[model samples]
Target: MTLKTAQNIAKQFTLVKAAATTLLALALSATVMMQAASGASRVKDIADFEGIRENILVGYGLVVGLNGTGDSLNNSPFTEQSLEAMLERLGVNTRDTDLKTDNVAAVVVTATLPAFARQGTKVDVTISSIGDAESLLGGTLVVTPLMAADGEVYAVAQGSITVAGFAAGGEAASITKGVPTAGRIANGAIVERELGFDLATLTSLRISLRNPDLTTSRRIAKAINDFIGNRVAKSTDPSTVVLNLDGSKRDDMVDLLTDIEQLMVEPDQIARVVIDEQSGIIVIGKDVKVDTVAIAQGNLTVRITETPQVSQPSPFAEQGQTVVVPRTDIQVTEDGDKKLTVLNSGVRLQELVDGLNALGIGPRDMISILQAIKAAGALQAEIELM
Candidate 1:
């Protein structure tokens, strides 16, 4: 072969090899992305349907039949009055009766009325002592009407209190387990009136994200629209995704919604660091990063000690007295084992934590260091003080 022809053939082979390598890289990248998307979560796990929420119902009730653990009638006049009124309603006249008893306690009953609850459906209720009742164990809660915020009766609660704890001892000292003044009754309250909300009659639905994020909202909208094979879902804001339901039959709405809810989508999260000052807890998100920064941590300790010495006159000379002489000593110490640490840019959450832990930094000290780094513009994530 001629020299010029050989060079030309080698050049062509190099170009072909490079193109093949690029295609392989692109194929690997696409496969990795598909694997990542497959690990996404279902829409129902991260978002809630608007207008479908529980309503809180509260009521004032009385618990009776305690074993000397009830509220004192003298100290809790409301308990006595409630018992008297209950007796009167039961056809027993207590107009001139002086009720004095420690077998009853005034309690506040609270329960959550779930959405779409029909009449006669039973729900759980929590009983908490409003008076100074030692325990609610083995007590039966009287029939009390639970009311909503609008002052309308929604349900009635009456059942034996199931206290998870107990208090027992003589007047000396008592040891209690769990919470003695609170209890719960499973399936305690029966629904007397529905909240009057029908999901089937709605023309459109709104999906509210639990943690608002613009990227997450868009992903949710796309997931729903793709599932239904139409442009039915639109992200209105970072927190809300609106679904257009016009021209859809009522029976189809349920099936469509079920499909939309089951669609899996990847949700985006904000890079953040949460620290609890009181509990010394630090939560660092996986996406949190820190820029290249140098850190120097050293502890300075100052200690002041006082010594009292007694001065006495020898042989008790005339007008001589004993006095206390105070001596003070101050000492300052700086830890010399600390060294300057240089963290690289784009430091991952685990790397940053490991670097800080290498310096024997506790959560309290780490909090201060993180704040300083954020102030210096080295920390690239939001710091949430909790």
Candidate 2:
């Protein structure tokens, strides 16, 4: 081939290789962006909408059908009084008769009413014995009206009690498993009313972050705005984000929430190290860091002993008398020589842990050492003692 033809061929090959390299770079960039997006979380998983919550409902009730472990009516006057009142309502005169039975227990029932819950919707209820009843297993809760804090009845609960634990024994010895006095009734309470707010009529909505962080709040707002292709979402503070809904989307509030809640956003977290002294548990976060610090551990032991000695003079000496004297001895010792080991500056949690582990220290000693480092401003994370 001619020299000019060979040069042209080389130029063509170079152009093709450059195109391939550019395509590979673009592909890698896209892959990285996709991976980052996959690791992000939805807005609803990290934040809760304002004014949308559960309401607590509580009520006093009675449980019947227990085998033989019921509250003593004599000791629990309220239990007897409640039973008497219930019986009187059922067209029975129990005031004259000494109604003594071991098949009844007084219980406090509790349930939660979800927001926008309609009438006739069932909710789970929990029953707890308020008296000295041994167990609530196999008991059936009576028809009890659950009331909210506003003194209005919201639901009625009634069903067979299902206890997670059991109690069995005699007067001298007994064995109990779990908490026998507490039980639950699934789908026991029916909603009698709904809340006052209407979602379709709402012009604005707000989200409250579980953990308040300025960067997270801004990112959430930006993600929502970008997803909707408008600047409708705004971060009001570190914990709150407010959104303005257009008139066209007001009728489709459910659809709007569905889209907004699914948008992904990365969240920020504080570096923290949590320690449970009782359980000797140490949890170090990945972002935790430490500066150069020295640690030394030592143990001191003390021992004491007592001895009684008898002193006697000559048996026939009138001026001498037998006597007893107490003698005591004390000893103290310390193990291991004191040596301060200098730990290099650690920029990662693993490095700090490795340095601490090299000292052959336990969790309790690690907790003390971490606290000392934090106090000395060597640790770059917050220390939480549990």
Candidate 3:
């Protein structure tokens, strides 16, 4: 072949290869865009398996080792009584004497016991002062038995308190950051008892959605059923999906739950607009729609000026007297620059925002306008006031 023909063939091959690569990249991009538009999320992110939850435990405790910042025993009689009781427990009888301790504070200790927590596992605890304590900055929490709602002691918490705030003051003023009366202790409690729950022995399970929606619940059940290749999952309501473990091929319920939780499904939500009147915050959902409506916003302002003048009698006449006279001026004005803006029917969130922006109104005014629109039966979405 001629050299020129050979070069032309090579150049053609290079162009063809570049075109193929561009086509492949475009195909991948389209696939990614489609997946993103589907809005699929893992089942674990949207639903929780039944019988798997945390339990709250609370207890009354005492915090000591404070530098004169603890509760005043004179003002807080419970503190004084508690000090005497604790001393009596330790073989030192203080019931006959007045307990004047400023380094002891009564506190409420709280902690959450996680599901399936072992006896030796540790959890964090929060200590909050229940009395007039100035600070818990350098205090240590005493041993406290944390109890669950069943009135049974579940865990024991004790550690040095970690206060995130501090207080400083002279005679005149004081400055405090965060909450000086509350503190946290990391990994301060050890579980003493295990909850009576057996996951492997359960024959059925219920999956509860974080946000209740019929479509989303059905989608989750369908995803679980399709993954197991059986009719094991069913949606009974908008908030719950039941799973029959007997029909499942897997014998281990743990493995079955692990597999089901990893499956991805798209969740659905209703169209609603959330408005916070206090903060002037407005949130428009993606599915929110609006009917055709005309919106106009304006404010009328009135200004008044007052000036007082003293009038003197003509050139000190015998019977003349000085008197005070009042002059007033008033001006009334209306917003003429604001005009009515019309929104088309079936307008989406973006179009609605654009139309509202065209009216040149602040969020406060827009809040009122949204309420007015809802009252007029023009907004298609539910209005939620916060």
Candidate 4:
């Protein structure tokens, strides 16, 4: 062959090789992305701190200062009792005399002590009338001991409740906003006792999942195991992830939490449909994918259009009084279009949202769709209506 033809053939061979290499690279990249997506589970996305939880503290106290709207002196005997008790504590002994009060309300004060609350720290308290009180506005709570479930006093709540609502006027007419029977006392309760558990006491740490799943738990265990040489984390249950701690491994628990929280373990969660009936709020998770199924969305529209027609007695009638003739009309429109989203592979949350949005449905409609999906065995999460 001629040298020139040989050169041309060599160049063609080089071009073909480059093309093949480019195709192979694209396939490899796509495969890696698919593998990563498959590894992502719903369990590892959210976490619940182990050994760290909120404690509910509650107390009973008297609310003073209401203009006849407080508990009835005759009906609510507890109010009188509370008043008498308060007076007795103040060195005034009138226990034998019958007492009536219209300026007091027996109320239950509640507060949540957040984890890591220190001694003497103040937290807000919620005051709700426990008696036949009309309003708790402008009432001062006397010294009340806030106790935990164990019956140990954790704090003392005392302050005038800042009721956001109020009732005014007599029996016939009254104006009120927010909630008159309930109010919040900002920073009213002082923490007296700290939590009993000492997290720093040489022991093993735990990584808890807010929503637990076996696949997610196993993935988390593997991720942590891979992050470090030792198997520091283990799944005791779907909700619990235990981490063995060595005193020499970490110094500050706070720092350790910071690290663990940032550790990106894809979470796994049971497929669930959650709905807030009052608010019409619905949320679908990314893992909420469906098997091969068909869904139909429809809209039923009721239109009531008023065509006001004024009628006058016949042109030559004596009264010729003009009157409005009610021409109320009603029509219903149905959506004959049905769009379906084929969730062949695992779909992400954004995709699910987009699919639902394409249905051209409202909050209530979406809620119905979710319910139907769950019923049809297409939706893979728990459905909870709140």
Cα-based TM-score, every candidate: 0.83, 0.80, 0.87, 0.70
Off by over 4 Å in 4: 1-45, 226-228, 251-255, 276-280, 291-382
Give the winner by lDDT: 2 or 3: 3
Candidate achieving the largest TM-score:
3
Cα lDDT tens digits, model 2, 110-130, are: 999998899999999999999
Ten-residue region with minimum lDDT total, candidate 3: 28-37
Tell how far residue 99 is off in model 3, in angstroms.
2.1
| Candidate numbers sorted by TM-score from highest down | 3, 1, 2, 4
Give one digit per residue, the lDDT tens place, for model 3 in 1-386: 99999999999999999999999999978966775689878899999999999999999989999999999988998888888888788899877797677899999999999999999999999999999999999899989999999999999999999999999999999999999999999999999999999998888999999999999999999988888999999999999999998778888888899999988888899999999999999999999888999888999999999998999888858887899999999999999999989999999999999999998889999999988999999898899998
Clashing pairs in 2: none
Model 1, range 173-248, lDDT digits (tens) per residue?
A: 8788999999999999999999876676677889999999999999999877666677888999999999878643
Global lDDT of each candidate:
0.89, 0.88, 0.93, 0.79
